[model samples]
Target: MERAVRWDRLREEMAREGVELLALVPGANLFYLTGLHFHRMERPIVALLPREGEPALILPAFEVEKAQRAPIPWRLFPYTDAEGPASAFHAAAAALGGRGHTIAVETLGMRVLEWSLLAEAFESPTPLPAEPLLARLRMVKGPEEIAAIRRAIAAAEAALQQWLPEVRPGMTEREATRRLIQACFAAGADALAFEPIVVAGPNAALPHATPSERPMGPGEMMIVDFGVIMDGYVSDLTRTFVLGEPDPETARIYEVVREANAAGRAAVRPGIPAEAVDRAARAVIEAAGYGPYFPHRTGHGLGLEIHEPPYLVQGDRTLLTPGMVFTVEPGIYLPGRGGVRIEDVVVVTETGGESLTTFPRELRSL
Candidate 1:
């Protein structure tokens, strides 16, 4: 019922924007609204219709049984590889009286073959990118959406706690990353938010360096940036730690980034422009004489996809709303001297912002 209501909201937005119908090909948007997962292959999967009217589900004949489990009200149109998607889509759209209407399709997921098939069916029908219209609706999460994110965060934190004790000098970066990846699966997570980032020592300066064979050295920083997926929702969190007594410069940089992260989090609230969050953290780093070292936006929306709308950057003016959720990550990287970054997923609340990840952000020196 929650998903149905959310879909209704999206449909309303599409109609208001002059879109007669919204079509979803294979992707997160499809999985989100229909609770159906279809791999890209010879078989094609799609959802078609306007928000206010009944939508049709176009699936391979073998996958029709899966739609029986969907909570939304939908008509099923089954096709086979022998018949092809063009014929199936044409039949489904004709059945729904959408043959001559303008339909919006996901630009990111609609393949060239699918696009041609969809085009061949509609006469003088216009097709456009539905991402902008759909993203507007998905950016502001609802209670159920936030709950899913909270669950993902809980699972990620549990996995992190389990791996914390094992963190020490001489351990290879890949070893630690592998440990956490396994923990995520063992903790009931369906998938990883993204590839685990485990960087140590000088490599930490690289914002997204993959885990390596380099052995962690004493007094050098190690960055563990990862998230777990729960029921399709994602939670991203990052923490930098030192194996033992740390260098004074490293410690100072850590403190500066920590303060910047805090400042950014504190600035998050309903009605604040997205860029303000970036500025709040940027100010902290700039005051510490590390402005140039702070690259990348302050954060991004987190939900069905790890990265989404209302990006916290220099020129984004989207106002934060109560149900929106995102991260407040700030970092200061010094070439050859290591770097420090702390991040936490937070939800905008009626009162302020509530952090989903509760892992300690303090500079941990083991």
Candidate 2:
């Protein structure tokens, strides 16, 4: 029932919003609507869905085989190199009645060259932003999507745990990252979501730092931030640990961040505003007198992409919904000393938010 309901709801939303048609390029939104993942090449590809009719796919002749796998019912408009890629796009626009009617498009995903051809296809060329409609449809997680995310988290967690024993002193950051990624493949992950962050000592102070040749030292704080992809969905997480015995000050900061992370997760409930959840974690760090060191927002949404709407930050008025899933990460960075960041994937429920990744957050000294 949920499987059928997922696609049906999107069509209903398009009709209700008075969107005559929707044009999606190669990106998360495209994959979200139709389960098709293809490359954007010289010959472009687009999925066109009408409010009350079947979808049409326009692509180069080479893309027809892959586009056929799209979940949505579609008509193919394939063109060859002689006619150019935009030729196929023009053919699709002709089917949609010269684009005088309102057409919804994803601004971020569509390329400039495609936009130019599209703009020329229309007489008035008024493009409506499709993010609101797309976001509305994707905000709630269906049973299948939830299952994929859970599986992704499990594989990612296993990858991190498998590398724990090898995180001893004298290990290069890049070497440790390689082993961690190998564990992900061994745990059945199809691909990694992003380049994993492997930072030790002062390098840990910079969030999103790349893995380097720096060797692990005794008592140095290390951060391993990584994610895995499963069934087109993504899972993101970060854990900080010490190589040897961390100083008392480092331990205190770790505890503060852990407490802040907990506070953020606890604040997620059905009527609370997104900003309030961020404040909940921010308050904890502020109370501990480390507010200045705690930079960046508490967290962001996770699903088709690493980042999305309903962000956990100050002044985000978006209210929590039961099916919404995001991360609750809190960090404290003291320049020249080190930093700690702990993150987990969580889904908002009727009772409260349920954390998907439950790796222990206790400060660990390897």
lDDT of 2 by residue, 1-366 (tens): 543565687788778878888888888887776767778776667777777666778787877888776555678889888888676777777877775767788887888777777777655566788888888778778778888999999999988888798778989999999999999999999999999998899889998788899998999999999999999899999999998898999988999999999999988898788888899999999999999988899988889988887889988888889988899999999898789999989999999999999898998887
Which residue pairs clash within candidate 1?
A: none
Report the CA-based lDDT of candidate 2 relative to the real structure.
0.85
lDDT per residue, candidate 1, 178-232, as tens digits?
Answer: 9889888878788999999988888999898888999989989988899988878
lDDT of candidates 1 onward, in order: 0.85, 0.85
Cα RMSD to the true fold for all candidates: 1.9, 1.7
Worst 10 residues of 1 by lDDT: 115-124
Q: Which stretches of candidate 2 lie over 4 Å from their true place?
A: 1-4, 15-18
Off by over 4 Å in 1: 98-100
Give the CA lDDT, 0 to 100, for residue 342 in model 1. Answer: 95
TM-score of each: 0.93, 0.95
Model 1 backbone overlap count: 0
